[model samples]
Target: MSSFAALRRAHADARFKCIFLRPTLASQRLGCPVSPFSCRLNSSTSESHVSDAPTEETPIVASEKTVPSGDDTLFHKALTPSGRRDLADRIIQDGKELHKLNVELKNLQRFARSTELLVKGSPWKVAKHWFATPFKEDVTLDNGVIRVGSQTVPNIWLRDNCQCNSCMHQETRQRLLDTFSIPEDISIKTAAEFRTAIEVTWSDGHQSTYDKDLLREAGANSEKKAVIRQGQVDIHLWNASIAESKPQLNWEPESRPHEKRVDKFIQGVLQRIRRFGFCYVNRMKATPEATEKLLRRIAFIRETHYGGFYDFTADLASKDTAYTNIALGAHTDNTYFSDPAGLQAFHLLSHTDGKGGASLLVDGFKAAEELLHSDKEAYHILATVHVHGHASGNDGISIQPYKGFPVLEHDAETGALLRVRWNPSDRAAVELPLEEVGKWYAAARKFDAILKRKENEYWEQLQPGTLLIFDNWRVLHGRSAFTGKRRICGGYINRDDWISKYKMLHFGKEDVLKNLAAG
Candidate 1:
């Protein structure tokens, strides 16, 4: 018999004695005589029960007829004080044994379930002792594919993604193996499925081991792939109504007891920014240093030609319209750059002699959706036509992407909107062909109208000590003209940096980062 079978047999015999023999033996020791009829019944039942497997219906102890009394009172009264203590200890010991048996039974059930899975087949199994069977009659071991239950993984793919230390760097987690060196028609020499993992020896004699999780991922279907892609950040589109329920996080004091507040604050801010594209940090110190420090929590500051971590008054110090006290319309900053800033933060440190410089924010995504539904032709034009922008206000400096980009960018595979680049002030000359120029102008007007709608604008006169951070790629920000010495302190963060932080926070420690890290 197998070790498991031997152990199971031992448990049954021990349990039967503990359940049926303990009462009779303890009663006889305490001077409660066993009647002749009880002795014959016990002997016959015990002899026959030795071969009978213990089950839930098994009596916890011998029947009361075996004892010289009708109830347990006579047996208890017959026991001395020392005997009573011994009896109590015996009960506890038996209880422990019963618990162990119950645990072992549960393990046996799980083993049976896993065996059933191996026989019937499953797409994926997370059991401790998992096994894989061949997928079909035609699928053999030496073929180019290895079957794990119902899933099939190509030999080349398995060899290329080997997680061994020699193939993948342990510290950096980057592939060191030459993926191209492996033959396109590679085949498996042998495959062995162990209790916990599958091992495959390639035709070239290179071995690779895959755990259940890795195996499942290697054979995931298109539906599962879509779910995995869409599982990250959930975008919540909003218009003016978002102003009523502003997404904001309160700045907590940096005391020892409240140290965890920093983590909560950072997570809350990132989650809100990801969902709504903007969030406010209220009750901050409002200093340039403080704002920079808080922003660095998410990522390093993105330096531009103007400066990094800039703090300036409305003095035109940078020779840009944003440095002046003019009412700028809804537009995204740095539209002229090849890769615009990902996140932008602003804090109204002080605003002396100012009355009407309330900041305006518009959800470019919501406006784009409106355009898509209201006029498909205009949306198509905006999505297809490329536009150029420039930042040449500074002396001896002109920045622009080598080629123009579309106003509405989208993910090719998912057809989901990815970015919006719109800036009327910094827009360069229209370089479209004569025939398409009119169509582009009409599309531009339609988009501009949707952006300017009253209900689409979210206005707020940023208060002192409050910091407002928004996604520059999705939320268009501007300010009303004012007459005052308004000083603002803020900076931009690189898109890739903040996105990395958000993914880490959202997914925690998982294989979701394997592809992200490779990129």
Candidate 2:
């Protein structure tokens, strides 16, 4: 016989013996007549061979639930061994519980949908009936309106008095009515004829219904007519135009008479400072006369130690002791002083043979603005936290400490930004309640990340005869280390001086103090 035919006959013989010969009594009870050949083979095969076939067939028997084995069902045996009956029972119970939960969820969803439909049908009416009724009953209305209590609402609700963008274009500041004045002659034809919603007939005779609450909010019942002003001054204009204007740097000698071009340049620089809090002046000789001329043009000059005309020559013996060799990071100079110098002026006398000295300026105001937009809560924490700085180790002079000023300060009356605190290295640990310390650190980190951004950086090499001036409070200045000799003559001029000079040039000889006080 062929090998495949032999294997098939072997499998058939094994199945026949297991079905008919192994369970002779059971087969006989069911009227399944055992074949003689199957009985002869079962008797000839070893007991082990017969046991293997019967074990395989027993699994099939358990699968059909024909025989109960220790109360375990056939489906349970299919999923797991018969020994894990408790586990199978738990799984079945869990399935039943999940089905019950699904039914409960469907019932809740149906109720929610029904409630949403009822509320959306008449949202305003429903809200008024619920919250406004008790107060409404206490208010009274004259003419077509019945007396509810003390308050009075007009029967004719105004449809045109809406604040939506469609009715009032926010960008253009245009309202539905160019002249938003209430109608002068409003008359009720009959008390009974007037409904809660009076049809509003416009000048063009088109009619629309308005809600009673909306009309009251728009001052419909007031005796005085409402007129909306269209062209109010926008405060954002001052700060918004800072980045719009081109920056300028004026360079002229103090000894020479002010030319008309230089005069206009100084005025522009001052105006830029007032509007944007910073400006730059370039291309002038770094002589004491040139530096003084620029400083004098400002309102006031703040003199520091080793004052007057000086040179930054690298000859260790050079007369200029004011200029130091130390490389500085971004910082407002003299922050350790009581009233930190407001405006800083630097004149590059000579950078002969300097390999790597470049001046860097950063707008602290812009950095703070970015922080406020990203996370207002973090911004608030920074504004509330107090920071302290000191330079006590080397210098014998102890500077007055600063307190209670916000990193991003805004004017309370005008809502204009006033100052920024961005010194990281020198910042002292602030004493706060233990709970608030963590939040303060988080806010400080956010502010630092924004200040360090490359986009906010403005860098330029201070060539010979270049003078740059900026608001010390708003602009943080720094420089890169130099390989060769680099020299710079720098000093401070107060902001009040700069502002006075700006006002004198722009608004003629008008007293700035008088104007400021008036404002």
Candidate 3:
């Protein structure tokens, strides 16, 4: 039997005497009858009798009869010297047993709650004894699989994920034990389940305790695991109509230590950028240093060939068209990078003597989705064709991915579109077979046309003190032709870093690992 069940059984068999309290003089004045402390204590399951006036030695049998008020004689039933001593001894012994029973019950409840939450998404239905101490009959080991409660897990995976302090650094959450050191033919010597966790002893003499929840999650499918890691942020794909109600927030300078006012504002900025692929932070100081400080709140400025936290005018300092007074088509930045920048921030510090430098944004993911439904073949070609992109405009700055990537990239496991790498200006020569060349160009042009469509573009004349941050993977950015100087300041944030900040803020630090591990 489980320890909790045993404790309950023992408590049920014990013959304990409980002293009942009747209404005192004070309670009588308040018009109260029997006090709540007046509880019947049954020494045995069988019914018994209680005399009109019983002595302490006479068992305090269960009775519903209420003693008349002011009957002092019945209230203070005299106890013999020997009876008083016996009652006191039994009271002390039963109190200790009762405490033990309560402790056991509390532990059992905690185990049940934890186990339920952990195995919530499991395919197998949990049996009643799921929280009990697992025995030989409850578990099985065969063909390198350990089956417990109808759920099977690989023996190697279970051994590698040992949560013992010797195997894993508790504070750092890093694996101290070498995974390869584990035996390839590892076997379980013994396995036992408790209310909240499972204990396994390996044939190699290493022991580990695995939480039931972690086990279920590790055994889950790929798509469910991805959801855990990415969280449930609703992505709102936008078109030109988004201009009527843009995702934006107002920035106010922090005036005091640990000020709570800016907490909501910062969270608002992150949520907007995450959901809509971009957000604008208005009413900030129009300076390079100020813009850098704001970007640092999300993550450190990511340095590139151009610079870290850059501030520039139309001076061609980087030998790129972006540094010229010309209109650029909608395209994602850093297509040449293997792991392109995740987020890009832009703050038009000043645009004096400029007529039309309206910033343009196109939702690449939305456009890709449209292509997938409207022209599946075109979408497939774009997703499959590996496009070579490069940045060789500046001296000694030829940059390209080691392996070319698709213009429309999707996650291999989930088959969900993840990134868009489209920058015609920076694309390298087509390296495809002549027969496929025509098809590739046709598909590319079709996607480009979708991006440049009037209904797909959201344009705004960015003003000084209005900062914009966008996801470079999902949003294609461009600028209209301008007349004179148009000063801008911004920088890139690495994909992993910005996403880390978002996950940390969205799901607290404690849960970030739980989700990431599942994925």
Candidate 4:
């Protein structure tokens, strides 16, 4: 019989005696005269008959019962036919599960036994048993780490990261091997370490290598880089002083300069936007199409009811206050947009015979940060409250804005300021509770005061051929009322595209890992 079968038989016999057998001395002490009913002490299961006889119509029924222990089970004897079947099935199932578990345990032991897992000069195994696997691959020791491939990785990690045709999907580039699929006995076939990296041929005959520096950058020390993302604005709060040397970048020459010069100009403009969240471009043709071309160089134009770009000339039909020369408040262009435009660009095509049309800018993030510090409760209220914004009119075009967002968007984990959206004109009527109404108004008023403060305002009388772009989510823009003709044209770019472009320009290690996982 198999070892498991013998073990199962012994277990059953032991349990049978425990339930059905009793000592002769014990029966005698109970005053039940020991006749043929006495049990043998030496045998495991000494069968006996009860003194009380059964009638002809009745027969003793056998039964087996089970009890559970913390991690194992036990069976009691006198098993019925059905009980014997259950016991057999349970024993088989338990044996199978136990065998699987033991295999995993043995795998771990074998892994630890391999010299590939041992540190240099390991004394656990004699030199003879250490070189069981040979490899044509190279290995390396780098900066206090034993590198496998270019990374200081464990043997299991190396085994898991195998990227041969069988291990990884060709089309998706994702690994196919799972923990269970990688057997416990998996090991390094051959390995070596070098100055810069490590290489190993796995027991499966697949070779892999890793660099030392890349692995460290990929894990453990990545917390800081994980929090901040590329293309996310690093807002620099500024006041009126920003206008003196404001974020300014000149446009490419009308004659079209050399490619290098054009590249430099475009790079400078993008970098300026990264730093100041806004920039003023110079020397562009005063036409709608030309303005679009300039904006497209940065990103695609975001379209809306206002069309591909807005011409701020005196117009009739649109419900927007922007079409009129009325003084405008500092606010994001699309407060009613669910995913509001990330950036807004404006090109001053012509400003012929106009007065009091100065553009004003307020760093909403800066203002929100101040509110967060001065009245943390109020800040919390704003961040938590869902303020709705909407815009509608009887202008035959069936468009009505209905969007909601907190005035101050913050990182949930770190409480860091992220995006700021504050637009009073487009703010839908609030229906807060009587008590909460007053507090909300107070918070709103305080935030407004900070935005209008002279220290937070940057006004400029934009001249012709000047293109202004700003992060609409971070910086709020407005205009003073104008008297005469003032024409302008510009477009919007989706935030994701700009971020993608920025990431390409400034790709980081985290991005690499994210892409790999996505695949």
Going through the candidates in the order shown, the clash numbers are 0, 10, 0, 13
lDDT of 1: 0.69
Worst 10 residues of 3 by lDDT: 17-26
- TM-scores of the models, in the given order? 0.68, 0.48, 0.70, 0.61
List the global CA lDDT of all models: 0.69, 0.50, 0.69, 0.60
The true-versus-predicted C-alpha distance at residue 452 of model 1, in Å, is: 0.4
Give the per-residue lDDT of model 3 (tens digit) for 407-463.
988655545557899999999856566765898899888898889889999999999
Candidate 1 local lDDT, 265-332, one digit each (tens): 78789879877889999988879988998999889998888989988988967889899998999999
Q: For residue 489, give model 1's deviation from the true position in Å.
A: 0.5
**Two-way TM-score contest, 3 vs 4, winner:** 3
Ranking by TM-score: 3, 1, 4, 2
Pairs that clash in candidate 3: none
Candidate 3's C-alpha lDDT?
0.69
What lDDT is obtained when candidate 2 is compared to the true structure? 0.50
Candidate 2: deviation at residue 46, Å?
A: 99
